[model samples]
Target: MVSIIGHHLINKEEGYQILLYLDPQLIEVADEFDESFQNKEDLRQVVNSYVKNRLPDLKVTVIRVVLGSLVIASIPLLPGTEIKDLDSSQELNLKTEVKEVFENTPQEIEKDLLLVNKNNSLADNYTPLNLIVPEVPFIFKGFHEKKLMAAKAATALEELFAAAKANNIELYAVSGYRSYQRQEVIFKSQVEKHGLLQANQISARPGESEHQTGLAMDVTSPQVKFKLVQEFGVTKEGQWLKEHAAGFGFIIRYPEGKDAVTGYQYEPWHIRYVGQEIAQKIASQDLTLEEYLA
Candidate 1:
């Protein structure tokens, strides 16, 4: 019959499980896992093949356990360690034990996020932003203040452009992941154009910027020069993006009236990729990333 003794690997909820059976005589197993197969060992090679084809990442095992007179086929649950030379417990002892391995898995991983710090990693960045990039017609170059973007930004941007076209929205990446030096140049240009007073209202200092992370974008419709000014957001396409961008794992970096904490002015054109779930929380609560993090 069908058994549940195997890894229950899934896109959203993946982990380990076990399932097996026993017979009355228990002297001999009617079937033994091909070692090449899994919980569905009763069928044939096709069973293992099916799971392998569908889940290239899962490692399956079909084993036989003795239950007094009957021998049953089962897949036993175990820790995340290798199953080879298993010596922790005897065969009959495993029948009544259960361990919550996946439940024990940590919710977040520590990473080295050099942009935020030399160490910033999330073991589980469960932010659900549906922001997948699609194919694009062409690529365009952008500048913030007056500096070039990173290669990663250019690549990710091409995907955004493609997604915009397929979704029937006019979108473009005006500026993308930039560097400290580039940001310094941009900060200088803004100081020149808007003067120091107005410049702080727009441009950002080098180390204090998110664009350096290669996961943000300054965008607009093709009609605009990728500007962070007014008219861009009022456009139909801009308005649409403002309403639905978070669904795609993106967030409007700085919106109206949060400049006090953002350390800058409201910029409708700036979008950051913080994954979908995290971005949604940031958007729904009227919180900037800086505020949310704080």
Candidate 2:
């Protein structure tokens, strides 16, 4: 028996497609993954390695399959490459134009690049524009406000999660787009549990939270039991975020040893999307958002 898994690199309606056919023994392993995957080069390498190790003598032919009603594009095949098309309706028209794939423009610089911190508090009634839920796995189920983020940031986040999946990394969203009132409740609770001083170090006041901007997200992995703890920074998923997040328009909001600059303890799980350009600059320079803006 073989298990087949499929994913679209772009929006569901278009882009390159990935289909994984795993033997029965590997089915259980593949079952653990979410429905979609990305990063064509990395996944292709992984599949090739697996096929080689499993059956060295087997001959493999790489051919693209066009499905019925599916407008497929960006197969990565060379020009004039012929593919097997199976259309349910009429004859399938083949187009071999090699256009760029996954070309998402970076989010607008002004709003998405907002700097939020203890000193830079938002207005009490401030709410971000275009809040939407990203199509990534979350630690909790059911409709909730924390699942929301600005539309542009959410799209970047989806790409980030897809890349993580392609690299065999599992990351889950824990929190996003919290309101000022919610922040107040959390801050008060933290203060009650661990004194006002400790709360100031760990929790943000109502108006002084990055979550209010809808550009920040807290992510975790199964290895850390989906908890927001400093230990998560050492896990493989967290390590991957540190190395690659900036490439996708995100950054570790509070890095270790920058507590003074950030006004908060190191929170490796918290990633803030500041668009790719600024994110990369801040990450490369090892500067906090405050420092970068300054």
TM-score leader: 2
Candidate 2 regions exceeding 4 Å error are 1-110
lDDT score of residue 97 within candidate 2? 34
Angstrom error of the Cα, residue 235, model 2: value is 0.7
Write candidate 1's Cα lDDT for 1-294 as tens digits.
Answer: 432211222122334232221222322433333343343334423223333432344333333332332233334434342334233241322232222233322111111111231111111111112223323332354323323333433444565556667878877555555556666688899898889888766776544456655567777776565555767778777787787777666777778887776667777888776666776787798777656654
lDDT of 1 at 24: 26
RMSD (CA, Å), candidate 1 to true, equals 16.8
TM-score on alpha carbons, each prediction: 0.49, 0.63
Q: Model 1 misses residue 77 by how many Å?
A: 54
Candidate 2 at 114: error in angstroms?
1.2
Write down the lDDT of every candidate, Cα atoms only: 0.48, 0.67
